[model samples]
Target: MSASNRPAGSGRLLTGVAWATLLLGLWLWGRGITDGSGASSAPTTGDIAAVGRPHGVLLPAAHAPIKGTAPERIEIPSIGVRAPVVARGLDKAGGIDPPPFAKSQTVGWYGSGTRPGAAGAALLVGHVDTETKPAVFYGLSAARPGAKVRVVRTDGSVAEFTIDDVQVFTRKRFDARKAYGPRKDGRAELRLITCGGTFDRASHEYNANVVVSAYLTGEKPSAGKSA
Candidate 1:
């Protein structure tokens, strides 16, 4: 189920051409995206079939974009995730390198892209499970709209975001731009991604991906600093 703890290279999530395609979409359309539809053949938690903003759910307004520093840590309160963030770039194969399986609990940020809390969408990827057990983002599919995600920056500010959309996009229907691009211009956005759907025995990979989208709602000043 864990792709032997190797989520990227072993035909899991961000495999060779798939990763390149994603980056291409990100480059072609720098920011802003619309909602899409689709579902996973193998559902997890609840029905994850392209769950967008729930009806009647009033989300907070997007916070103004801020100058962002490198993220030191990330917290998803609903999922009980508190993990360190590490910068990751393209590997030799030209695909976005994910965090090593040995450090399955860590989160990998696309260092070359927009920083979290910045004007554009920041990309954060993690493994859903390991060979032995669930990994960092195991409960990502269960995350619903209105969940809170907090990113602690190196500069000491804590950027808080509210989840707005969650989708289980199958490989055939996955839109890289929609999954990773900003939802609105001039507002900071975040995407939490992991492998989802059922594991394909033939391909040795997951059939779908779980993408959780969020936007900055507020910022807590650095510790001991006046707001």
Candidate 2:
């Protein structure tokens, strides 16, 4: 889901224009795989339920305070991404708000969902392209299985994950069951999401969303120690 590959859609979710706005704003502000270790673990039924419980819901305003700062950093040498992560919540519309896009800044986490490095599947969503310009996650589609993803948390801890799979789903066909679905093992997982698919000229947005799934390989400061 690199900025160049961002898809189109209507004024739904994060508007393409808004995405562009976010990217442009960031640029003005400062600016800034491979080899598999066997079948990656899958989400357990309970894990899936936890994520789906809040499907399409916006994060409470109270959580907005955590929107900035690097709870972690994600890197995929194969795709050339090594951005710090922040926390982001949904706007009044129940869709994720744009994440910070400045070069030195970290990407945002969905303040509404489980934090990355948590026990369950931590979810993060960003814009592939806000407008015609490339935004954070613009190159997400290039990532492949076996790529490495690193997360550095606020607690001075870091967790490493390996890319398990990359999937795309139409907005209408988006199966929340699968998007936030649980793994059978309850292993910690991460899901990075962005808009993708065909761009609808009339709608000015992408027809679908792109999703990247990864699993924790190992981490410093221990896996579930509130990092």
Best by TM-score: 1
Model 1: lowest-lDDT 10 consecutive positions = 10-19
Q: State which candidate has the highest lDDT.
A: 1
| lDDT by candidate, in order shown | 0.75, 0.53
lDDT of 1 by residue, 59-162 (tens): 98888988887899999998799999999997664456788767878999999988998898899999776545778888888888999999999989999999
Q: How does candidate 2 fare on TM-score?
A: 0.63
- Judge candidate 2 at residue 77 and give its lDDT: 74
lDDT, residue 25, candidate 1? 46
Candidate 2 local lDDT, 1-227, one digit each (tens) = 23334444211333554344323322322211111122212222111211222234332111011212246666667767777676766565444555544332246676656666555567776656544356667777666666678777776666677666676655444455455543534566778766565666575666555567876766666455563
Enumerate residue pairs that collide in model 1: none
Return the lDDT, model 2, position 194: 66
